[model samples]
Target: MEGALERSLRVFSGRGVLRTEYWDATIERFHLVSVPPDTAYQIGYTGTEPLWIGAWSSVGGDEITDESTLEPAARPEGNAEFDRIMATRSDRDLATSPGYDGEYDADPDEDRPEPVVTSFANTAAKLCPKAPEVGCNADRLAWIAELPELEWFSDSTVMKLDPGMYASTHTHFENEGPHEEIYWVMAGKARLITEYRDARLRRFDCAFFPTGNPHGIGNVGTETLWIGAWGARGGIEGDFDIANLDVADRPGQIEEYERVMAARKQRGLPLPPNADILDP
Candidate 1:
């Protein structure tokens, strides 16, 4: 059997779409997603705080050949906090174990950057509960990437929507008709509805929303729905940025939410508490 580390390196080239699950020195709980075409990967992770993120991109959509001098290391260079965290890594961190055999070192010359933890725990922990508070329709949410650390994408994050919370029907930047986005149900179940389509998203099921589309997601399962969301090379992407959302046309969504609340009321169920704020 091929070792997990070797197998990951074998297919982790900067060409095409590559997906693998890794339990390295810096990663704890993890989930990744992305869009297609040029290639993208969104990862949700918890680990030592990192100072920079590394990723690969082709110079002109061809093979990644550029000044990307990033070498492959279990964690970013010069992160003492990360080193401390890894020292106490759980037994589940198999790749870092002494007996594991999978390993790959980047060719000293190619030095292509690879996909990183698109999401970070330190920042994720600081995000407001309402991912897009203004236009969203949900009352309760457990989201992970309000402000992710990446180069090509923005407003990308993951959320675990409990039964009572929902993603309000809205578009990216509202009237700004074009946005590319990805939503994947990593675990549990969810019901996603877009301007033109709606379906139940089960484990590993994903829905892609191209530009100029509207969509929303909510948990329809008994357990919390773990969702992985991402976007590609567009939108408001900066070191610490969140997209500007417009709520002018959100009354319709509010009306729809009222209906759900009414149903909860009819069944003698209280609406989930709506108070969520970033701490001061």
Candidate 2:
């Protein structure tokens, strides 16, 4: 049984399309599928308890143009901050954790750079200097300064808010397109209020704000909360360094707001009072 189980997860190197098989012990059969190049697949259960699989590919034509066959371009080496973060990481922390494994391309044509890594223990929290006047009542721990290879996203920060605190009411704007952003609750509850919608989010909950959407969030629960925010890069090149937000785009609310004050307002639209979190 152990040998069969080990073989079930084994991977081999090959070119062109790849095939994978899932062994369903309940029915004693294998579900086989082919994965095209430059495509990805995942298997999981739906909310209704039905098994499902999904496949996705990049937009445009079926084939993606390969990188130049000539010498690969020089990639950006680690900066001072990147070096410092790497220095603080211990070997044990970099090692693969138990109960997790993945297959990798053994050899590739293009030059691949080493991944930059860090932990919260190696970083410190600082007062968010961007929009104190806008009532963004939270401390920010930035991650983008040390990760330059992250080309698409401009800002990545883990924000911490105490109970009864409210974030800024502003829209992140980009000259070329609407600034897309995602907020994922890491440790607490959040009430995300935007121009068109207001949602209460719990741990593991995520919300996406499309371009031109003005939004603000608050710590609605009694305990301290933490949320991870990532926004698409746009506008002037140097603007990315700052939290390029149009604070005046919307009216500001109180510095701190209780859940009861927010509940009094209508639920469909953005809340006037700041507020959410999970327990149990």
Candidate 3:
């Protein structure tokens, strides 16, 4: 599994042309310099740009592999000293500050809820019932996994499609800019169709679609298909190619119409408005 996971990571990371312009610009902009050996270095990030650090070491002109030569490194003790200083400052500030009125019962730090646990089975599934008008071919299902709000992620979902079912090729955007997507095949086989290339997806296999790349999936095996997907910044605004998709079983045109209308209403559009469309 570890080997396969590494291979998948490589496959996704190397999908597109690598760019070093931003990296070069950042190095110049920050006046960055390499740290000298045996020297302590630190950086306080302001979240203005992406930053990553890597370390490497070699012993006797080769990589270290002998466990017998390993020794326990000293852990940083600055945290304890910093905490002590902060505690002393806090105490001095409180002594000279105004007394609290006790209007709030709970401490601000303690007000956060405990970690939430949920499963794919327990999460509500987004249904895609067959609708000819919408160019849907079959009934499909998707579930948004319950997770704490993330800083960079907008979606964490599991989608299912039955044999012979396919979804329309689509691209997702947020705030008028293309957002990235990643999908891992959890069960069954799939044919990932994208504008740039198509690939077969097996259980445990993963793929990533970078900005402006349109993609979709088709269940090409005998069993049901399940895919775990994650998207950056949510990617809710979509541009779909409905003609290429193949949908299957499920009915009720009225229900489909109602669902469409409700979606439009949620977007704060007029009740009897033209179909929502995206510019190419």
Candidate 4:
């Protein structure tokens, strides 16, 4: 992932479109949109695609409209206090456990118990410095920073897969309600393998995962993969994991999953049910 300084530099360099946009509730800091020259100006390459790239501020909900006009904003003065709070919640302590396996050596009809605490809104708020009122983990992922209050919010625990650790077979439960998500790669490389398409994902690459689709991620390289995931809530309860069931064993279920994957591929979106690895 690019450092804070590098990201700031890139924003001012005009390498891409840089603007702040309003999202659900908060104002995103740096939103980059890609622009290209006319077809006649082509030197050698001949491709017409708008490449969108950029980052945003996770704090203060401030938007950077004009990069050229942006002055160096002073850092929060209370360094000691901020350091103390950050030290208490390093990356290791908040790491997520591996996802549940889909193999059913046991009974398939077994019912799992509902968690006493289904929502993390309160917990996340306490941990986050921006919106202390909401309990979502501000430090849940590697790339996101803290943010202040917002009318709407969504969050989830994510794990980046290390290449050469596992195969590409997995399953994610479909939510009963409407929801949408984006999978943004922070570091390394990955390949999203679904019933329909197999696409490569790299640093700064992003893929969208729509509701009701079941898919998984595979590390396509030897390095550790880091990803940032943002999505809306559907209030569903089901585990996302790798399943051993083959298409021959469950043709109907596999067919439905494939349809979703194919649709997303047509629109150049990521596969649903993004990668979830279990820790041994």
**Ranked by TM-score, top first:** 2, 1, 3, 4
Candidates in order, TM-scores: namely 0.47, 0.48, 0.43, 0.34
Give the Cα-based TM-score of candidate 4 against the true structure.
0.34
The reply for model 1, stretches above 4 Å from the true place, is 1-24, 31-115, 118-120, 125-137, 142-151, 173-178, 233-280
**Best TM-score goes to which candidate?**
2
RMSD of 1: 13.3
In candidate 4, position 118 carries an lDDT of 17
Our tally of clashes for model 4 stands at 12
Model 4 ranges with Cα > 4 A deviation: 1-152, 166-176, 234-280
Q: How does candidate 2 score on lDDT?
A: 0.41
What is the clash count for each candidate, in the order shown? 3, 3, 4, 12
* Stretches of candidate 2 exceeding 4 Å from the true structure: 1-111, 129-146, 175-178, 234-240, 243-271, 274-280
- When 2 and 3 are scored with TM-score, the better candidate is 2
Residue-by-residue lDDT tens digits, candidate 4, 1-280: 1111111111111122221110111112122211111100000111233333233222112343343233322233233223332232232242111332222232222221111111122222211121111111122222222111211123322344565332223233352224444666666777755556667778777776666555555566768766555543333322331122222233344455456556767878654333333211
How well does model 4 score by local distance difference test?
0.35
The total number of steric clashes, by the backbone 3 Å criterion, in model 3 comes to 4
Q: Cα miss at 88, model 4 (Å)? A: 30
* Residue-level error in angstroms, candidate 3, position 117: 2.9
